[model samples]
Target chain A: MNDTIGITALVPPELMYACGKRPLDVNNVVPVSSSSPSNKLCAWTAIWRDMILNGGLDIDSLVVVAGGDCHNALVDGQKAELSGMPTHYFFYPFDGDTDYLRSQLEKLVRFLGGIQDERMFSLISDLKAKGRALDELRVNDRARGSDVFSALISFSDLAGNPDIFGKTLDSVPRTDIRYSSRVALIGVPPIYPDFHETAEGFGLHVVYDELPYEFLRLGGSSLDSLASSYRDYSFAGPLKNRVRLIQDELLRRRVDGVIHYTQYACHHTLEDEIFRQHLDYPILTVQGDLPRPSTEQLKLRLEAFAEMLGVMS
Target chain B: MNIGLDVGSTTAKIVHVEEREVIFSKVVPSHHWTELIDDGQDDRCIVSTGYFRKKVPHCAAITEITAASLGARYHNPETQVIIDIGGQDTKVIDLRSNTFVINDKCSAGTGAFLELAAHYFDIPVGSLGRLHSLATKGAQLNNTCGVFAISEMISQLVSGYSMEEVIYGLHQAFALKISQMVPSADTVMLIGGTVRNTGIIDAINNVLDSKIEVPGAPQLVNALGAALYRERLDDGR
Candidate 1:
């Protein structure tokens, strides 16, 4: 169970994943919404602005947490530094090593206690089961249809609670839509939900999302197996490894094209040339600002990319 | 005759081709593309591209990136790169690989940025060429957004900087933004309505320190590419 935290710790809900409870999220301070010119991301800016306008924030400990890779994480750190908050910055080592990852997990475990609780084991089991259930839907040979879309949108929503997640997945509505091309989206998770809608509108069904959010993908049988899975997972460290993972999946899933979503001011999005160079398939890099839906430009590009990939008009 | 219409945000361009030869081409103030279409002319198979691409009904719709590459290939089969700096957006195409990189959601890297900056300087748009020819040093301007850039230019003007120095700086800034996107490359074939500005062309040439060619009828390249797409599809048929 200690291995579970060691594996999935770097991506999101960062260091506190070992605590076996939801971490404090500053993101909930306000709902991210739209603005003109589209690049002035309204996420944290609005929260701080609103708080100041409403006469100062009433908080004790504000800690910015990130997996310590890419600019979004750096931005979180910068925001913390600017706010003078106690922040946790976890720098991911370039060389993929279990020892490096486990050190952070150990520090976190000591800080928060609960090193070996039976609940953690049960949690892992339940999570693994839920993860398997989500993967099963990816195949969609069983008429799970549009529930797949809702299921994807809600994967993070229902990940922690295993009890009703299965029941909820069963009850969601399903509608089958024709997809002309199969696509994979990498880089930053979209700023707007309509990002997904736009791709579907362009007749490109997104089969693989490389963002760490939606599938925990705790792929292994035992604790050691889980750690091995993490060791093999390339998204953790080097660019070459991440590209390898994406390239393998592209061939395995038979993807037609790739739509990479990159946020402005983010490092990962800026250095998309590596991904483009490594991936043998056609790639369209979509750079957008936060709090805005898929723009007309992106839609036009998507339509063009889809057409270029031979999607039937 | 195959008609290709590039419907941009502020202007519309049309290219008429017959038997793979461009017979007629023109750009007009574009409120509507159908206005450019000759009355009762349905014999021409129309193709559309650019900003208002969806508004124009056509048999085939190509993206500016695809159209640029197709048009560049038609011009130079050995074409390696095409940089299009238009009013709406700037796109850098790696024609050899058929890959494209568009700038972030900002007008900073486009000709519109220069135009906006030029407007703030109160230099008549047509006189920019003569002004550029007379200017020597480019004053460093840091603001990337056109809106903020105007304020920055105002500050420079108040700070005892010559207007020519500032205007030269603005042109260099425009070229620098594009150079950042292209990073390193050989001679870049330039296209778009923005390329007609000789002042900007000189600035880009100085900044890049490399050869830049403006293919004849630069603005109509996309429209011709749209027509070429129809030509390819027709050939395939």
Candidate 2:
């Protein structure tokens, strides 16, 4: 149940790209791609597609994770209404206080009615344990070094069995690269495979992946407290404060530069420029569906940026 | 002597530079680069760029975006921004500092779009300038994609739109798509083979609200940049 929300809510924007919509809309983040009936889809989108393909849309109730500035709530709500499913909306507030979380949680409890009694707490504990275990295993995997793309796949979800995270970690080869400059890759999850490898090949070790390897477990002792932490997820904040968590990580991890990825025709690409203005480190802003100009062209640009940053001579 | 080959999607370009001066250049269909190079071509320092750079051997390969930027700067030192429309892609680069932005995944504001419009109207691409010269400022074309724009062109023609006027709209429509990419720019340098279309240069200037000066040989600019880069690497500047 927890993984269900995470997978749907943390939609890797590649699905948006595949839809052939200019400036990806959360509304078109539909379970099916009507615009492009046949574009290669990654695992995250594959799961979303398979769910719709296998009749996951036919449901008694719909939970809309209403997030983002536009279309997110309205689209999800419209989808539920269109399908004739009795619907509930969980608004991920862009800015919040503890009172906000408490009030929302209370309203949710009222909506669920008897869910507050006991089963909810047990479910929360199990989810908390499982999420933490996944994060721990993921951290261990990164420390030992796994293939960047494969690592992101393991981090996609708990893989239905959270215990497999450790076994999956052990299965991949580890590469411990001592580096000249450590960088953090931020923004929409990487949809391009060559980008990570290209960055590493150019001599910059991607020490931190802010969005892709995101294991967002809001820590707390109890379910009610957990709601407060969950509400504080940086993405739910105003644009200025949105990447506060990412900024903190950059400082803590000693990151030197940032490679910010974005897509064209995406209303969300606005976040890319905003992050550029916010970060103090040298940031290389890359936009579009694939390497701009061309793949080797983008690599040269990366190498030049890395060289400029003294990451490579 | 140094040779730079740009194997683009729609065409192949080669430029010969001697001591940083471009002495020779040519543009041909992409398939002919191999045959051109293999038979009677002076072997010199070789650098390549664009989509097909890997298919032919070269001393180094660079992305067209970066090459285009360096190319634009080489043509005009004051070039602060670059708008390059190629066979299949369009790019906007801000060179006041390092920045690269391209149209999402769609090939709407590219050379391919105009090629479709030219074929649809049965107007020689080279004669578009003459057609635009005769046209009064025309109707706005909302669809910029190749397929839909062709359909839109047919509708305009059937709806009794003037042939020259509709051709002008195609240029303006391509310009409009370019405007949306960066939204606005100061001192934007327009390059790529499509820049030879004088109507596009005029429409883009109107859309950007700034006059854009085209390089002497616009198609040769990217290949020239790669050639100069080889000189820079050898000379260590």
Candidate 3:
């Protein structure tokens, strides 16, 4: 039986699979999680940390994306490690240094017991190509944003099984989506599980989900290629690159507006102003603190944004 | 004739418009909203907005942000921004960018903050503006949190500041809390029932760089906007 490895943030699932380990993106379960962390800055890290500490998740080891991801996860991940989960800290290069990322990947490979089946890398890369196609379906208006979002977001760890995950992606219904405005959701995904559906309810169809797209866009069939591809993970690098990448996607998606969903106390929340200054689109910024269903306040903003784009524009 | 019904958190407002001109208007407590439509008007003729927009009978329901925009544009075509201080939340809408920021998590800049002060002073909320006019200068209130501001208010009173002066300080605190949300603009229109408080308007003028304008019956703008929306639907333009 393959050992299940827990990940705090975005780590190369292909490498984990090559090392004969099932990578579980812990953040995947955060939105639907009911646990209330006693102390937390960002609910994403805190809930997952508490879940691991409380024996909620079954995993052999944990990988903490300490650097270039969520700053809060560093301390929270340590709490889980202290509670006895075997842990490894992985850092993405802030300068887009492929050599540095390759070294980090090598260390991560060793932590996962080294590559046992190198073919797993190519297999996962092929699956990611399918993920990109699923993303394109929504961009082309051939799929509902909610359905596409669910499938695209899962690209992080492919639901821990390539075969089952492939079936899940294929199962996504294809249908033309009609909306009052096309909006791009940038920054971390909303903590509310039903955020995409709630936005669709207000006639604002999300055509681009930033982080989830990152999951599918960066993958390779070799360690050297993987390092180079994931090194350009926009979120880990400079804001200007992320901004440029987001601007490109927004244009490609023909978004009428941008919704920057910032997590409460997450450092990325500070980047809201920069995106507002750079992104040349109507932008509505919303913050979430806990994982739950979409709140009325959020619905009001979505409804108002849709009205503004549909009526005023 | 078209009817606009705005049932907000604190109050319910209804407006009647005919040929682009307001014919009649009325304000009632939110619970007494039924009184506004007791005349057996057709739901198709009514456009509803505010927190209870969908809950109320309406042919079309719109958000207060859109209502405020359309309503403010009717008052001033070139209106750039709008600061709506409702009972539970305050929304700063930048019409130029077609974006808005709502401060709902905290009550500091909202009408409820002022209501807390009024309840503490045992005075009617309406008289706050009149009392604000009596103060020569306000006592200092640096805290922007609604709960903490109450302590600051009590501190001001303990230091021999008059009740009117404390009210003046509270208004200043409220305006400062709201000013953080408003972006740079040439003109900002203030709306929502709370705008009827001249104290808040005065503090906003002191704090904001932009020229502040309040339409007649500022509280009825959302209702007016809802009515205007009905007209737009009729024209189908």
Candidate 4:
């Protein structure tokens, strides 16, 4: 029997599985969710918060990634805790202090009733390796970007079960991808549900999804290794480090352009200027306010971006 | 001859190009967009752009941003940035980086904002430029929001500012709102029908440090771009 644990942001799925718990990423449901949260700054946190409070999400306990990643979750997570949901606060060290992250992982393990199955670590490590292969398929144009993005974004919680998630990864259709330009999507994921598909419609092949790639990139066989790997989680640490990581990925991926998707009022929206200055690529910065189908306004930007990269280049 | 059709939020424009030169161009209300193409033209020879780019007859449809880029570059090969102030939205395209920002969420910096002010004054929107020239000193209207700025405009009217001065202030406010989206550039090309308003050009000049240049028949740039794109396709460039 596994307890379903809800996570507001990237909490180690391996640790949750090791603790005989299933980690469910709450933000995963947000893009497809129809929840219209009143009195909200960032819709991502607010919608998930409202869903947890309104009994929309089924979870035995909640873990809020408070220290690094999503500042709004700090307050929203407490709101859920105040409403009688058993919750734990997990922090990622902003300075990449492995010792501090190791301590935080220990606290998280205790919150999850301690690791009950140690073999779960290797299972997740293998799954992440598969995720990396799926990512490579798209980068090499052997797989459609939209199909690959749908699978890659789910790496956060591996769709709640590693075995089921592995099958899901296996089920992703492998087909040759054709596009006008290969682009990397940075910043937080777009709130629009059909964003990748829409980009594909406009002849832009999304080679990299930033945050989702982070999930597949960082993993380990044990708590000590996990601490070292996850501590360097780019979003958790300094901007310079994240920028350097993104630059390397962009180069490795050979992306023709970069699209930075910022959610309305998300703190990450502030990083757009820094990325534009540092990335040295043609960067298209787009913003989304609410979770809905991709708008004509967004499509215009994507189409224009494709044209700029394709026709102009 | 190649035809370029641009049907936007407020108006539809068409341009006829022959031998890389625009021979004729016309603008009409968006709903009457058919009038621009009613001269028995082949659909295969036409390229369409803007809001109704896909909804209209065309051989190839492109976004306004792309159209503006191609059009501005055709006019001035050294064009760095393009500030296209249309009826409903304003787009700032930087040709150097191939990046652009569109202000559609707010009406403050758009042509609709100016139209709202003109409606409040009970005057024709075209007369705003002439009226703006008459003001000696403009009043201050600081609100960035189009709705809130109207209230501020009324307050200025009540505070002894003349109608022309209030219009000047409104233009200044609009310029300030749009200036935020325009990146630092050596030369900025102003396009779209809204550039016909000299008041806006003056106000934008006052607010931005960059040298502003408006092409002849600024409104037809998108239409011309659409036509030019057709030529590009024919030449396979």
Question: Per-prediction DockQ, in order?
Answer: 0.29, 0.13, 0.87, 0.77
Per-candidate Cα RMSD to the true structure, in Å, reads: 5.7, 7.6, 1.0, 0.9
Cα lDDT, model 3, residue B134? 99
- lDDT at position A274, candidate 3: 98
> Per-residue alpha-carbon lDDT of model 3 for A171-266, expressed as tens digits?
999998898889999999999999999999988889999999999889887889999899999988999999999999998889999999999999
lDDT of 3 by residue, B185-230 (tens): 9999999999999999999999999999999999999999999998
Per-residue error (Å), model 3, residue A1: 1.1
Give the top-scoring candidate (DockQ): 3
TM-score of the A chain in candidate 2: the value is: 0.65
Order the candidates by DockQ, highest first — what do you get? 3, 4, 1, 2
Name the weakest run of 10 consecutive residues (lDDT summed) in model 4 chain B: B36-45
Q: Order the numbered candidates by TM-score, best leading.
A: 4, 3, 1, 2
lDDT of 4 by residue, B89-125 (tens): 9999999988889999999999999999999999999
lDDT of 1 by residue, B58-140 (tens): 88777887788778777876667788887868888775554677764678877677677667766666666667677777678
- List candidate 2 segments past 4 Å from native: A1-7, A10-64, A67-89, A100-157, A160-174, A178-183, A191-205, A212-217, A248-270, A276-313, B39-44, B158-161, B232-237
lDDT of 3 at B4: 89
Taken over the whole model, the C-alpha lDDT of each candidate is 0.64, 0.61, 0.92, 0.92
Over B154-195, each residue of candidate 2 has an lDDT whose tens digit, in order, gives 788888888888888888888888888763455888888888
Model 1 chain A worst lDDT run, 10 consecutive residues: A1-10
